[model samples]
Target: MEIMHAVDFRTQLTSIMETLAKTAVVEIGKLFEENSSFLKLEITRCTRENESLQQKCRLLESELQAARKTAGKINRTEASLSHGSTGCICVDICTPTRLDTGNCKLYITNTLHACFPDTAHRPAIDNVFGKDWCLNLWRHEESNAAPNEDTNLSSSGVTVEPVNLLEEEPDMIMIKEEAFEKCSSDKTEEDQNKRLRGAIQKQVKEILPELDLKKLQNVVNHLVYVVGVEKIDDLTFVEVTDLKDFLEPIQCRKLVKTLKQKDFFQESNEQDETPTEITLTPLSSIESIPEQPFFPYCPANSEWLQRFQIPWDRMPPALTQATATGQRARPGARREFVRIVVAAMQAICPNPNLAACREVARWIVSTYPLTFGDITEEGEQLGNGYSCLQRQLKTRVEHVNRDIMEHRIRRPRKGLATKRGADEESYVGKKFRNCKADSYGCVNWQPSSIPEGETPNSLEMKRKVAAEIFQSAGPRAVELTNVDDLMQQTYVYQRHMINSCPPPSISEIELSWPFLFTERGLCRHFKTLTGIDIKSRFGETLNAKAKRILNYFNSQRLRWNEEIQSLLSEIDSDSDGTDNNKTAISAILLMMKYFKEKETSIFISADATSTKMSIEKEMTLPATPRLIMLGNSLLTSSKWFISIEGRVSHSIDSQLDFAAALAVFFGCFYVFNIEYEESAIATLELIQRFFVRINTEGTKCTSKSGTSRKTGSAVQRKSQNFHPRVATFMQRLSEFEWKTSN
Candidate 1:
């Protein structure tokens, strides 16, 4: 009975499934039919629309043909009139009418006294435009030609009164208004352009009187496009094309080159209302400039001139042309000029004082205003116009002096004993002498003694105690403990250790002074030594200048090396904490490039693929400060370690913000009493003197050589010193700041 009941249930289920499948098939078929019908309707509608568009296009083509025929006939009639007495009269004597075909026609018949063909077509024109139209047209042309006369005569000898077109045909006035406005605007624009050209020419002539007038005028023609343009690249394509049309390609190139010059567009302080009267100084006056003989201060030019076998009285033709005609010399020529001038100064004295340089510069400018004069836009001269010349002279003098000092060449005066060398004044040494910890100058560089009641022996004991606490720590509560006082007491002893001739290795120092490696301990130590809040100052400055610094790097993207370019690309692609690390690393790398230093000099990275044995070998190397990035992708890692004394001394303590890491890296130079790395001295010095503003001077960074001679003391070694590139960078950075501020 159970088997019979099961069979019946299975049969019922089979019948139900077949019925549902049939119903679904019907529904799907209905849906497919509806979709097909909708698609067919859309296709039919589109076909109809396409057919309508084709018909419209054909109609437009036919109307265009008709308009062309009408235009051709009108042009022929106008050409006949132009060859006759009405040639000079530019008048629109046709009334425009729109035809059913959507083309506009000039209906000459609607215009009274409109021009027509000669007497052969006179009857036809009279029938079309009414009688005497040709006669009236001739009279109209004669009247317009002689506007001062009240009447005009036709071929038939009838006197005709001049008619005012606007009064007689008010409707024509509307049609002519647009043409009148267009003509007047073109005339005004032409006049404006002329005035702009004249103004630019006058300014250029006043400021640079020695410029060739023909070339100056050509440049001036293009200056009209730059009336309100700030940058040369900002000129529009049309404006640039127009400029090219006015001058040859080479002349246009020269114009752009001149505009890019730093001194070319200096703002003038002179009042526009009171234009200064310029007096032309004759060549005779310049030729008569009294020669200022060099004495104890500066060397005489005769010695070097004789050495080079150059005629003393006669200057090089290149120099003469540059000075006399104000022609810009080639780079090679200018460099040769500097070399010759430097040789002259170095003959009697390898190092000339500032006064001597200024005196020489003044003589040059005074003798040749056309070449050396630094004139403002208002034609006012800057103090002697010789500061740039003075700077170049000083730089060349120093470069020669460095070579002299490096080779230990002596230039002894006849009557005087050998003077101590001024080369001993290292910018770093100077800062160390009057060292302050912050912008508020204070003399805390050398702490004479430890805190009261704390003897040197007791501080040593406390340092050991702190070390024990650090070593045994499981997240040591540094802030909650009294380790701060212990750290403070041991600071004097720590300085002594750091300043030791052969500074202790990272392990030795850490073992003795473990607290110094911690964030709090490092901050306190740097503050006590230099009076700067490293963490706070680093964060503040980085936040303020990060975008600008990145922008500066971005601007030089094409100029960087592959490694640096790769790093910059990564920075642009990522904006996480890793980006800051890459930014800081790239900045250091770029600075190294600017100073022509090697990357391995200050930085060594460990790749993910790098063998443990290789890193272990790097760890066993000599004691020197270095930024260490662990892992591949070149400093993209979150952890940046400072390796001083062949070991990782401290990890960057910014929770991945590398600005603080950078600050500490710089502070290591001061803290360790380590002279800048020999290979990266200038790069490091610029960071110290300019960005850090530790031991800054009013003078520019002028040193050209990269070698640093060790003085008597290791800590007192001279830096690689100046880089003109750094000076230029500073200048541009300041300008960038000024632009951003405004």
Candidate 2:
């Protein structure tokens, strides 16, 4: 029994040990699988992190390159190139988050120009800024953090904190409130003094309304310069004594009393006026000085200082005084001035004419002329003066061009000579076009020539006498405003212009645009078209008959002219006949009426200056004119014209608005009719005065008539998705298939 019990205990122990061993193996296998899965996940997370960092680095590098390119442009040198793209983030205030590309520099440059026009004249860009205005107005860097030099941002311990793209945080923002300082503290004081003086003038006006306020302000400004205090109450004993020089003691007391009564030293918060920051280049004490230094060092002074100084060579008689207004000396005119000198020199020669390309270096001097010899027009070269003149001329041309494109009607400023005499009242109706007081000064009439002493013969004698007469009347020239006397002077000027050219035997009549509305329009048109006067068989004046014809034409029944209308009237009664000359007159009147009523009319800009009047005028038309045949007559008769959207196509070119177009059309008409006239040659002279841009692009304006178009291509284009209203308008406007046929 003891042996059996011992054997059973041994078997039970062995079974328990086997069960424990199996459980341990299973647990170990499960732990190994979990560890392998964790390792795979960790690897993937690290790889993704590395990729994201690489992308950020690439982004940073590209932005840096773009900033460097922009900084290379003008005015970018003001900001730190290092801080351009780094831990220092630049938020373009104009367009935040979006990279500026080039607009940043352009906006700043334009703003600077608007502020200081003298910047254009100055040699250095740095000199353009006012001392009060901060140069770094556009940029603001992290004030606290020093800019780090680590090109590889990853290495730097200084982390680039992620910015909120949608909103600007206080510290992250670059532009501070006080970035731009408009005026210095001194200027503010000067302005305050001016205001005080203005108030004083108003208060004292009842008793002393005639007081010169500007004069009073000048006195106070000078006092401010010497006193060196902004607040009026802060004036020291010395300043008071200095003020006494200009103002009486009682006056000074009253001024001070009034200022203190208003609490002028302590400005009220209630004042809502805009900050008067900019003045029209107000001169400080130092700038107002005539001489640059205390005593300028010059050869003129040296000559005067010497006891035995040689007499300074001077002109025997003074030619002219230095007048403030811009007026050239009246170089005398020759009989052939229009044909010879004025017509000889071309302002711009795009395609070189060898004869016209000869050197103008004799007229314009050069620096170090020995090394840099005479430059010819053929070489497209310019000396200092010539280059400057060309630059100014180009600027004016561009200005006029921009006006034509944008305004499409009239310019702001008018002609100095013609506008006042003809339609000065027209200008008075507009907001900005009202004639300025100073703008209407001396009658400095154009075509004013001073005689060249080149010919000392009979020509020179005649010019000398004319010049002497002008010189004797110099004071009168200055004195005479728009009085009736100036009209006689203008007639004299007109005489000088017309002597060389013979009068047209063809009953010439020059009518202004306004004169067309009167009865004179038909009379003038008849005379010019037929080369005949309005005289009957018995030599009786038949002006009344012309008036009747004008009235009939005004009724729109006389489509061509009075003669054509009479024939049409007779046709109504079964008797018909029409004259070709009458058709020409009808065409002219039809064109003129259509032009006057046009929605987008080409106006002769009153701002057309003397030197560049033709350029300004010719550019007013959007497109050049083309000859069209109507009824196979070959002549571009007035009937060739037709209306589009109440706009006349041929009228723009046919009118005297563009001299070149008029000459081209009229000359073509005459040649087509197999007739020659001296008038064509004279009109050619007028055409030469203008600088016209010939449209060689082959891109025809939809508004223009008789444009040669390409055909033979069958193109059924796919439909576009334009707005309903826009599509309808375009459809109506582009219906030029019939009208545009050549």
Candidate 3:
């Protein structure tokens, strides 16, 4: 009975399975039919939508044709009215000064013009605009003023009869209204651009002072595309295609890149990029510029003039102008031209000696076709106002040759020193300044009991100070703690660095535990001192592991000179063409970065020809930014300039010469035909001499030459074939002092 029941159950299950399979097949078939119908409907909808778009496009085309016709008519009217005048004209509306309200009024003038061929005028009927901003078809209709009438802007506005749109034909008025609206918008854009240019230029001078004007030549296409695509309203700059324009593009990019890096701007979103109202923020407030000279006070122009000797007078005729269509500085205008150029330089510099004159002249001459345009024919060489200007510049530059050849006239300088070699005597040994006690975290700086006026400003009483500092470290020295709290304290400590940072006081707790800080600067400080990265994990938790490694070097308490040298040598070895060298190189760079950022003040000798000047400066403050030039030849061949008789801060604290370091670092990396060790040896030799000079002379070895027998210093040493001119140039750089003022 059990076997029979089992067989029956099996049969029943099989039948049920078969029945369910059949039912599912029918249901799936129905679903397929429904899905096909839905797809058909979607196709129909899309087809209809596409047709509608096509129709709209056709309608817009017809409207565009009509607008173009209207524009053609207005163009004819304008052409007839302005038949005898230049294509462009300006009619300024001056504000009354008699009332003497100091506030300057906006919309001081109204200009009427048509520009940009592709963009037609659009109606702004709903958006009423002022006439001053309107873009109307302006013409001296049937019988008004003659073409030559003087329409100088005055306190009284231009006299004109206003035409009412209501009285004119609808079609004609519509076209005029569109034109007027466009003109208004363009005028506003122009004004915004003017202000933007001023702001941008100011930023360039501040951030990228070493940038040469030539770098700006290739930025037009990139800038225009960015502005047009992004519709960047704040910088709605127009592109100029003139062959004579010398715009500053590299400097512009430098400013923008820096601002972005500093978080002043965020990267533009690729998605959801719609044109929105732009808000431009002014750059961060920089330190006030104290009255100072234009050039570093090296006071050795005879060497400078000879070394930086340029061929200013060899005004090579434009190579493109292959046909020697002789163009000379016009005979009668030559004297006047020279006079104007000299006068302009003298007025601008307050002392147009040959050296000063040369510096300004090189910049002027770089203006290319703008300053010296092509002269195609005989009359082209005639002294027009533009030609006169060019001639004047050339004449001033020519003075360099005369001075160098004759050496008869003494180079005139400010405070003309009656005694010879006064520059050397006046500036020598006078630049030792006391480092402020509160300023901590200085490279190799130890706590000193003596003041600025006292000897031993820089002492290596490290073991004693280390005990005090480590004792204060207390809990921080024991173990890892809250990183956030430590970072805040470190931020406050950095602010105590008076010259580079703000004058902020660090509390006792913060001062006691500075090494516990895990900020960018503290990380750099630890890495520079010891080869270990204390804050590898960017956030809190100052690497407890890395801290152990710092014990070795920190315990020894090496002398300041010994420490700096050991660190540099280690960096040099690690940074030599290896994948793992980035950290080491970065450590070296951080040590010099702050000093490079500080303002460097220079006093240009009143006499351009003679190098006689003094630089009064504080070692903590800088005059100009020093750029690390790793151009096409960072590792192979880099140049070091040599000039004599210049000044640098007499403070020993300013010993890390950024320029010399670059020469050493890149000189090692540079791929020369010589053996790697040979290249490194030469670079190391240069660095050694730099250190020797720094120790003997208070100056960074800039003013006194290694060869200057005037002091108890070693003879100027040379590695291989270091150029004499380059040596001289480097010598002159050591004598400048820093501003002791706020």
Clashes of each: 2, 10, 51
lDDT of 3 by residue, 156-248 (tens): 565444443323433443455567787787666655543443344433344444323432312222232223322343332333322112232
Model 1, which residues run further than 4 Å from truth?
1-355, 358-390, 393-443, 474-477, 500-503, 556-578, 608-614, 617-622, 696-723, 736-742
Model 2: lowest-lDDT 10 consecutive positions: 689-698
TM-score between model 2 and native: 0.15
* Candidate 1 per-residue C-alpha lDDT over 1-742 given as tens digits, one digit per residue, 9 for 90 to 100: 9999999999999999999999899989966654453355357546645644565566667768977986786566445544645432333422111122111113333332344434533212222122254346545554555653333223334434443332344333223345569768766655544444455566555544423444455445334322333222222222334455433232333344443344444432132332222222222111111213422223463233223322223456777666544433334454577678767766655666655765666566545544554432222233225555676777777776775664345355653332324444344355343322221111244455568887777887887788777777722445645788777767778877765645566677777787777666777787887656777776655544545666776876887678667767766676564455566656666667555667777777676444435565655544767766666655465556677766666665436566766676767766655555556666765565444544322222222344432332234333211334554565455445545656
Using lDDT as the measure, which candidate wins?
1
State every prediction's TM-score relative to the real structure. 0.41, 0.15, 0.29
Candidate 3: regions farther than 4 A off: 1-178, 217-408, 411-489, 496-511, 514-523, 526-742
Worst 10 residues of 3 by lDDT: 692-701
Compared with the true structure, the alpha-carbon lDDT of candidate 3 equals 0.32
Q: Candidate 2: list runs displaced more than 4 Å.
A: 1-174, 180-197, 200-210, 232-240, 248-742
lDDT of 2 by residue, 532-576 (tens): 232121022112222333344445563455554554454344221
The model with the greatest TM-score is 1
